[model samples]
Target: MAESDSDSGNLAQVRHVVLVLSGKGGVGKSTMTTELALALRHAGKKVGILDVDLCGPSIPRMLSVGRPEVHQCDGGWVPIYTDSEQTLALMSIGFMLENPDDAVVWRGPKKTALIGQFVTDVAWGELDVLLVDTPPGTSDEHLAVVEKLKKKHHVDGAVLITTPQAVSTGDVRREITFCKKTGIRILGIVENMSGFVCPHCSECSNIFSQGGGEELAKLTASPFLGRVPLDPQLATSLEQGQDFVRLFPHSATYSSITTITQTLLRSLEAA
Candidate 1:
C-alpha cells in the first residue's frame, strides 16, 4: 500500500537542518548545496532544499523547477516542488516572481519578515534534512536566517563550503566567527574547486590553488570533509538541471562529494 498523504506534507520532524554556506561568491556554494541534497536523497534520506538567496536565487535554475505554483491555504503559503521529482520541498522567491530576474529589494526588517514566512508559513512537509542555500557574504539575509533558526529550532549543524583560495578562506573564517557567536556547530568543511583532473593523463592539477579550505579547517579545528575537483561536465549537468550525484556517481568529483556526505551522516548519526 502507498504511504499516507499526511506523511508527505510536513517536515517539522526532520532530523537534520544543514545550512550550506560559503565566505565568498563564485565558490560553487549553491552547486554544492544542490549536489549535497541530491546525494542525501540518493542515500535514502528525504531532503528539502531552501534557496534563501533572495536577491540572487539559483535553485530554480539548477533544479529546473522554473516558476513554482504558489497557493494560499489557511494563514500561510505553500511551496511547490520541482519536476525533477527528487521528493525535495523546494522554496525560493524565484518561484513566486513572474520572472526569475525580478529583483528583491528590501531592508533587514522586511527581509526578516519574508524569511519568517519562508520558515513558518510554507508547508515544508516531511524531510530527513533541510538544506538551506544561503547567499554569499554575511549579509542581513544570512544573519536573519541564522538568528531565526537558532531562536526557533535546534539546528543540527552547518556545512561550510569554500574554494581553494586565500580570499575565500578568509571570508570563511569570518563565517566561522559568526557561527561561533550564534552557537551553531560546524559539521565540517567541503573544499570545492580543489583542483582539476586531466582526462588524458588521469592527473589532478591545482586549478584554484588547492588546500586552502583544508588548511583553514585545520586552523579552526574543524573536520575537512572532502575535496571536489572542478569538472567541466558538472557545469553542463547543473545547467541542464540534472542531479550530478545520480548522473555521474562514478566520476571522481562525485565520489569526493559522496565522502563529504558520509562525513555529515556519520556525525549526525553519532550525535
Candidate 2:
C-alpha cells in the first residue's frame, strides 16, 4: 500500500472529506474549491484544502500565500494558514518547489507517492471539512487519492465541475463514470461559466450554450447544485488573489456561489 492502512488516526479530526473534480482542465475545479472553502469559512465552518494537482498547484497562489515554508511537527506537516482567524488552511506542492514557474515533470509513480504522502501527512487538526482539488482527467493521481483516502480517512463524496457546453458535459460524463466505478458518491454537479455577467449593468448574457450541465445532471440522476456566471470582477479578484466572496457581496456570481454552498451543505446534512 502506498499509505499505511493502519495509520487512519491521522485524519481522525477531519469530519468530512470532499473532492472537487473535473474531466477536462480549465473547467474551474480549483476555482470552485477556493470559492467554496471561502464560503464555508464565511458560514463559520473550519475548512482545509488539499491541492493534489501536483502538475499545476495553483491553490497556493489562488489563496494569496505565495510559496510559504511548510513546517513539520510530531503529527505531520503543518498546513499553511490563509487567514488571521485560521479558519482556512491549505497544503500544496507549490510550497516545496524552488520556483513557482517550474513544472513538475515526474513519472506516474512519483506523483502517486507524493499524493499518498499528502493524504497521510497533513496535520489538519480539527476541521469541519477538507476539500481536495484534483488534477484534470481520471489518471494515476486520482486512483492514488481514492485508494489512500478510502483506506485511511473516509471520502464523503465528490463535487463535479463542468462548463455549459456539450463538449464539457460529455467529458464530465466520464468523470461521473469514474466516480461510479470507484464507488465515490456524486454529491452534485455545478455549471460554471454558464453565462457572462456584465460588470456595469449586472445583466447576464449567454456567451456559450447553456443548460448542458443541468441537463446532464438530470439525465444522470444527479443533483444540480447551481450555475455560476462568469463575472469579470470575480476573475480579477481571483487573479489578484483577493477574496471576491467578501469584497463583492452584491455581485450575481457571489449569490450563485452562496446558493451552491447552501445546497451542498443541505446535501451533506441529509446524507
Candidate 3:
C-alpha cells in the first residue's frame, strides 16, 4: 500500500461528481477521464479523480502518477496530490495492491464494499468536480460508483465514451438508459477514436468505420458531444506522460474533446 496523508473536509464541498463510462473495454474511457481532468484543471478548477475501475485501474499510469500515500485528516483519509502547478488529487485501488501486477480477484460484494470505502473514506478536500473513471459496461463497478457517490454527494451526471463502431457504440447506448433509470442525468456522449490520421500526409482515415456514435446519439435522443479523431500525437503524449491538450493544443482530438468537456462544465453549473 502507498503512504497515507491527512486532510480536512467532507465530500459535500465537491459540487459535481462526473462518472465516465463506456459500453465495453478498450474504448479509451480512462484516457478520456485523465485528459478531461487535466483540461478542467488547466482552466483553473479544483478537480479530483476517483479510479473506481479497481480491477483495471489505469489513471495513475496515464497521468504518470506514482504510488501515492493515503493519509488521515479531520474529515477522512486524504488522497495524494500530483506534483504540478495544477495538481490533480487522485485515489485508486491500484495504490493499495502490494505490487502493480497484483490482480484484484474479488467478487461483487467485496468490490461494492471497497467502493463504499472510497466514497466515504478518502479525503477529497473541497473540489469543484470529481471525475469517476469506471470500468466497462453497467456492471458491478459502475453500479457501485453511482450508488456510493450519490449516497455521499451529488453526482452531476455521466459521460459515456464509445468508438465509431457498432460493436462499441452498441454497448455504450445502454449506459444512457442506466443513467436514466438511476435518475442520473446524461451529460452527453463522446465519440472517441472516430478516425485516424496518417502521420506522413496529415490525412485522416476511418480505419474502424465511423459515424456509429453520432447515429446512436440521434437514435437515443442523447446529446452528441463530438468526435475525437485518432491522432498519433495523442498516443505519443500519453506515452511521454504529457497532457494532450497542453502538448497538442491545435490537434483535432484536442479541439473536439475540450469542447465536450466545456459543455460538461456548463451542464454541471446548471445542475
Scored by TM-score, the top model is 2
lDDT by residue for model 3 (1-271), tens: 0112222125756767889988899998998998899889877899999999988998888878767767788767778677555358899998888899999999999999999888888877678889988888888877888777666666778889999888888788788888888888888888898889777786789898988888988998888888888888888878777888888787777778789889888888876
Please write out the lDDT profile of model 2 over residues 178-223, one tens digit for every residue: 9999999999999999999988898999999799999999999999
Please provide TM-scores, in order, for all candidate models, with all chains considered together: 0.91, 0.97, 0.93
Clashing residue pairs in candidate 3 are 3-69, 3-70, 4-70, 4-71, 5-70, 5-71, 5-72, 6-72, 7-73, 77-123
lDDT of 1: 0.81
Task: Candidate 3: list runs displaced more than 4 Å.
Answer: 1-9
| Candidates, ranked, TM-score | 2, 3, 1
Candidate 2 — which residues are off by over 4 angstroms?
1-7
The lDDT for every candidate, in the order shown, is 0.81, 0.92, 0.82
Error of 1 at 56 (Å): 1.0
- In candidate 2, list every pair of residues with a backbone clash: none
Instruction: Judging by lDDT, tell me the better candidate of 1 and 3.
Output: 3
Worst 10 residues of 1 by lDDT: 1-10
